[model samples]
Target chain A: MERDDIIEYSLDTHHDEEAGKKIRKKIYFVTVLLSVVTAIEVAMGIIWGKAHIDVDGMGWLTIKSIFIILTLLKAGYIVMVFMHLGDERKSLRNVILIPYVLFIGYLFFILLVESSFIFYVKDVIGWV
Target chain B: MAGEATKAIDQAELWGGGRSPFSVSYGKMMMWFFLISDALTFGGFLSALAFARHHLEDAWPVTENIFFHFPLTHAHLPLLYVALMTFILIISSVTMVLAVEAGHRMDRKGVVKWMAFTVLGGAIFVGSQAWEWMTFIAGPDGLLSTSADNASLTSNPYGPQLYADFFFFITGFHGTHVLSGVVINLIVLIRSMQGWYDERGHYEMVEKVGLYWHFIDLVWVFVFTFFYLI
Candidate 1:
C-alpha cells in the first residue's frame, strides 16, 4: 500500500519531539491530580471511621454528601481529560454529556422518591 | 435541467460519502455512544442499590467495617487496598494516554513501550480484583449460608443479607468489566508490538481502547464511594 493511503485521520499535532514531550507533561499532571483526589478520599474515610472526628452538628448525611461530590469531581476529570472529551468540539461534548446527565438525574429522582414512599409505608404506617 | 441534475448529485454525494458529522472519526463517535449507554446501565444498578439502602436504613452494613483488611496485615486498614487499586488504574490511564500521544507522533517504540506498560497495569488490576472477590465471598469470619439461594450474612457482623447481595452483584459486574478490559489491552498490546498500527500510520486504535480503559476507572470511582466509603 502507498504511504498516503495508510495515513489515518487524527487530532494530534505532535509533528516534532518537543510537542511529544509537552503532551507527556500534561499526562503526568493529570496523573498527579487523580492521585491526590484518591488520597483525600481515603483519608476522609479513615478519619471518619477510625479517628471518629465528630463534626459539630453535621450528620452522617453531610459527610456522605461530601464524599459523593468529590467522587463526581474525580469522575468528571477522568472523562474530560483522559478521555480527551475536553479537546472535542463544544457541540459534540454537549451532545454526548447532556443526555446521560439528564437520564441519570431522572433515574435518581424516581428511585429516591419511590424509596422514601416505601420507607413510610413499611416503617411509619406499618404496612408490608 | 443540467443545474437540477447537479444539485441532486451533490445531495447524493453528501449522503453517500463516509463523512463524520461530528468531525470525529466514526470509531471514536461510536465509542462515545456506547459509553453513554453503558453509563446509564451502571446508573440503573447503582440507583437500585440506593433504593435498597434507603429501605434498609440503619440495617445496611457500614462500609468501613467490612472493607478494612489489607494484604498480609491483620490490622484494620479500611479502604487502603482499594485506594491502591484506584491509584494503579489511574496510572495505567496515564500510560494509555502516553501511548496514544506516541502513536500520534508515529513513534512506534514509544507506543510499544507505553502500551506494554498499560497491559501490565491492567493485568495487575484484574489480579487485585480477583483477590478482592475471594476475600468478599469468604467473608472475614466465614461463610454463613442458610440456603443455596445466596450467601447469607446472618452470622457475620456485616448487617443484613441485601447488603451482601448488592456488594457481590455490583462489584462482581465491575470486575467482569475489568477482566475484559485486560484481555482487550493484551490484544492491542500484541498488535502494537507487531507494528500493526505502525503500518496503518495512525494510532487511533490506542485512543479508542484508552477511552474504554478510562471509563472502567471512572466507574470504579463511583463504586468505591457508594459501596465502600459512604
Candidate 2:
C-alpha cells in the first residue's frame, strides 16, 4: 500500500521519525508525572494522615484536603493528556470538560452540606 | 418552479456540513459524551458514600484502620495495596495512550505491543480488585459476621454496617468497569493485529478505546482518594 493512502495524525506526519519520537517522549513524560503525583499522595496519607499536626493560626493542613487536591490534580492531568483533550481545540475542550466540573461541584456541595445538616438534626433531636 | 425552489435551499450546504462540527470524529465525540455521563455516575456514587460516612460521623470506620492489611503480611499497612493498584492502573493508562499514539503513526507493531501491555495491566488490576474484595469479605481474623443480625444499627461493632456495604458496592462497581475495559482492550489489540485500523485508514478506534480506558483510570484515582486515603 502507498504511504499516502494512510492518514496522518500528529504522530505520523508523513513518516517523520522525529515526530514519532516526540510523541513517544510525551507519553513517557506523562507517565512519570502521574507516578510522581501518586507517590506524593500515598506518602501524604502514610505520613500525616493520622499525625494531625496543627499550624499556629492557619488551621491544620489536614491530610484530607491534601488527598482531595492531589487527586483532582492527577485526574485533571490524566484527562487532559491521556484522553488527548489537551491537544484538542480550546472550545472543544471546554465543551467536554466544563459541564462535568460544574455538576461535580454542585453534587459535592449538596452532599456535604446535607450530611452535616442531617448530622446536626440527628444529634440534637435524639433521632436515629 | 420546483427545481428553482430546491436550488434556492443550497443543497450542498444542507447535505454536507463540511468538516465534523467539533472537528472530532463521530466516534470520539460520542465517547466524550458517554464519559461525561459516566463521570457523573461515579461522582454520584462517591458523594453518596461521603454522605453515609458523614451521617455515621464518629461511628464511621477510620478508612486507614479498616483498609490497613497488606497481602501475606499481618502487619497493618495503610493504603499500600490500594496505592499499588492505582499505580498499575495509571501505568496501563499510559500504555493505552501510547497505543493510540502508535496508531496515529500507523505503526502496527507498536500498537499491538503497547495494547497487549495495556490488556495485561488491566487484567492484573482486575485480579487485584478481586483479591481485595475477597480479603475484605473474609474480614480480618475470619470475622465474617460478628452476629447473624449484623445489619442492625445497634449491635454492629464495625461502626455503621453501611461502611462495609458501601465499600463492597463502590469497589465492585468500579471493578466491573475495569473488567469490561480489559475485554474491550483485548478486542482492540486483536483487531490491530488483524490490520483492522490500518484497513480503515486511521487508528481512531484505538483513540476511542483509549478514551474509555483513561476514564476508568481517572475514576480509580478518585476512588482511591475517597475510598481508602480519606
Candidate 3:
C-alpha cells in the first residue's frame, strides 16, 4: 500500500544516485561560499585592526557596514541553501522568512537609534 | 476509502480541508513555526547586545583584545579561536545536510555516518566554548570576573560590565542551543542505526531534525558576526 504521508506531503525527494550527485554538488558549493565569506570577514577585521584608525570614525563605520553586509550574505546562504528553504515551496518560504525580515529590520533600527541617544545621554551624565 | 475521500474534495479549494496548504508535512510546518519564534528570541538577544554596545560608547571593549587567546599557545591570535569555532559549526551544518540527503535516498548507513560527524562537531564546538569562557573570565593580568568584590558589575577593569554580561548571556544562550542540538542529533543518530525510520518506511524525522540543526548553524552565523567578528 502507498503510504499516505509520503504521497500527501510529496516526499518524492531526490532518490537516485544521479540526482544525489547534483544535490551534493550544490552542498559543496554552498559550503565553500560560506567559508570564503567567513575568511574574507576575518581578513577585513584584521586589516581594519592593523590600520590603527579611529574606531568611531567614518572609516570604521564603513567597515562595520561591510561586515553587516557580508554577514547577511552568509546568513542568506545558510537559510536558503543549507536549510533547504530554497528548495521548499514558495509559500513555505514566504511564511518563514517574511516576518523575520520585517520584524528584525524594525527592531534593529529602533534599538540602534535609541542606543546612540542613550550614549549621548550617558555622555552628558558623565556615565560610561 | 481515503483516496476516494481525497478525490471527492475540491482540488482547487486550497484550504478547503484534506490538504496541506504549505505543501509540507504537518510536523515540518510546526517546526518552521517554532524556528521562526526561536529566531526572534535570538534576534532580541543579539540586537540588545548591539544596543548596549552602542549605549556604552567607548566603554565597550574591542573584542580582539578580550578574545585573543588560542589553545596551547601564548601568542596573541585575536579572534582566531572564535573563527575556528565558526568553521566547526559550519562543517557540522554541512554534515547535517549530508545526513538529510542520505535520508532522502534512504541510505541508512550514510545517514548514520553523517549524523555521527554532526554530533561530534557540535560536541567539539561546545567544548571549545567552555574553554573560551574559562580563558575569557580569567584574563592575562588578573581575574576577568565581573562579580568579584574587587570588580563588580557597575565597574570592571575589562571595559564595561555590560560587555562581560552580554558576552556570557548571548553566547551562553547560543551554546545552550548547540548543546541541545547535539543531544537531539544523538537520539536521531541512534534511532537511524536501530532502523526506526526504516520501520516507518520514511525518514521525515531526519529531515525535521535537519531543519532544526540548520537553524542552529544559522543562529551561530549571526552570533559569530555580532559577537566575535564585528
Candidate 4:
C-alpha cells in the first residue's frame, strides 16, 4: 500500500465544528441527568430513613437492593458519558473491560463459597 | 538473491513502521491498556467487599457513621470528608480537561498554567486523603477512649471485625492510588513547563496523562460510592 493510503487509514479526521458543538451539548445533558438521578437517590434514602415504616412486603433488604441498583446506574452513566467509553467501538471497549469483569466474577465466587462455609461452620456447628 | 532480500526487508521496515495493529501512538495506547488492568484491580477489590457484606449480612456497619468526621469540631459529622474528596477529584479532572483544550490550541502557556492547577488539585486531594487516613487509623475520640467512641475496628456499634477490615483495606488502597497519581501529575506538569513535548510539535503526552488522571478520578467515583454511600 502507498504511504498516503496508510496515513489515510490510520489518521482520524472525524471531529468537526458542528460535531464538537453536539458533543458539548450531549455532555451537558449527561451531567444534568447524573445530577438529577443522584438527587433522587439521596432523596429516596432520606425518605426511607425518616419513614421507618419497615414496609413488610419488601423489607429492609428490598430497600437496600434498590439503593444498590440506583448506585450502579449512576456509576454506569458516569463511565459511559463522562468518560466517553460510550463513543468507542464496542469491540475496543469490550476488549478493554472484559478481563476485569471476569476476574471480579471469580473473586465474588470465592467470597460467596468461603463465606457460606464459614457461616455454616460457626452458626450450625457452634464452632466459634 | 541477497539484493532482493535486502530490498524486501527495507520495504517491510518502511511500510510496517514497527507499529502494532492497534496503530495508536505508543504513549496513548499504553495508557489505555494500563487503565484497563487498573480498572480490573479496583473491580476485584469492590467485589471482595460486596461478598464480605453479603456474608456478614447482619453485622455490616453503617458506612456513613464510619466515614463521618468533622474537622476542628467536637461534633461528629458523617460523609462531609468524602464529599470534599469527591469535589477535589472532580476539580482536578476539570483542570486536566482544560489542559487538553490548551494542548489542542497549541497554547503552551495555557497548558502549563492548567497543568499546574491540575497538579495542585491532585496534591490537595492527596493531602485530604492523608488526613482521612489519619482520622480512620487513629480512631475517633482517640485510641484510649474505646468505649466512649461509638465504633472501633475491634468492636463496631453495628457488627464484626470484617466491616472495619474491609473499610480500611478498600479506602487505604484507593488513597494510595491517589497519592501515586499526585506524584505522576507533578512529574507531568514539570515536564510540560520544561517544553519536553512542546518541541515535538504534539501535545499527545498531555492527552495521555490527562486520560490516566481522569481514569483515576473515575475509579475514585466508584470507590466513593461503593465504600461510602452504598
The model with the greatest TM-score is: 3
* Model 4 share of native interface contacts: 0.19
Ordered from best to worst TM-score, the candidate numbers read: 3, 1, 2, 4
Clashing pairs in 2: none
Q: Is candidate 2 or candidate 4 better by TM-score?
A: 2
User: How far does residue B64 in candidate 1 sit from its true spot (Å)?
Assistant: 1.2
Candidate 4 lDDT (Cα, 0 to 1): 0.65
Which residue pairs collide, candidate 4? B68-B78
| Candidate 1 residue lDDT tens string, B139-169 | 6564544434334444334667778777777
lDDT of 3 by residue, A88-121 (tens): 8776788889978999999999999998888787
Residue-level lDDT tens digits of model 1 in A1-128: 21222212333334678887886787888788889988988998888742364433366667778888888888888888888899776778999989888989888889989999999999999989
TM-score of each: 0.87, 0.85, 0.89, 0.76
lDDT of 4 by residue, A1-128 (tens): 21322322111213445554665566557556655655565555445631343533456556667766766676676566555567554655687667666777688778878888877787668789
Query: Can you list each candidate's DockQ?
Result: 0.41, 0.37, 0.48, 0.26
Best by DockQ: 3
The regions of model 3 sitting more than 4 angstroms off are A1-10, A124-128, B1-16, B142-156
* Worst 10-residue lDDT window, candidate 2 chain B: B1-10
Docking class of 4: acceptable
Please provide, for model 4 over B3-107, each residue's C-alpha lDDT reduced to its tens digit, 9 standing for 90 to 100: 122112223323345433343444555678888878878877888787776656556666565666767775755566677677777667767766665665566
Rank by DockQ (best first): 3, 1, 2, 4
Candidate 4 displacement at residue B18 in angstroms: 4.4
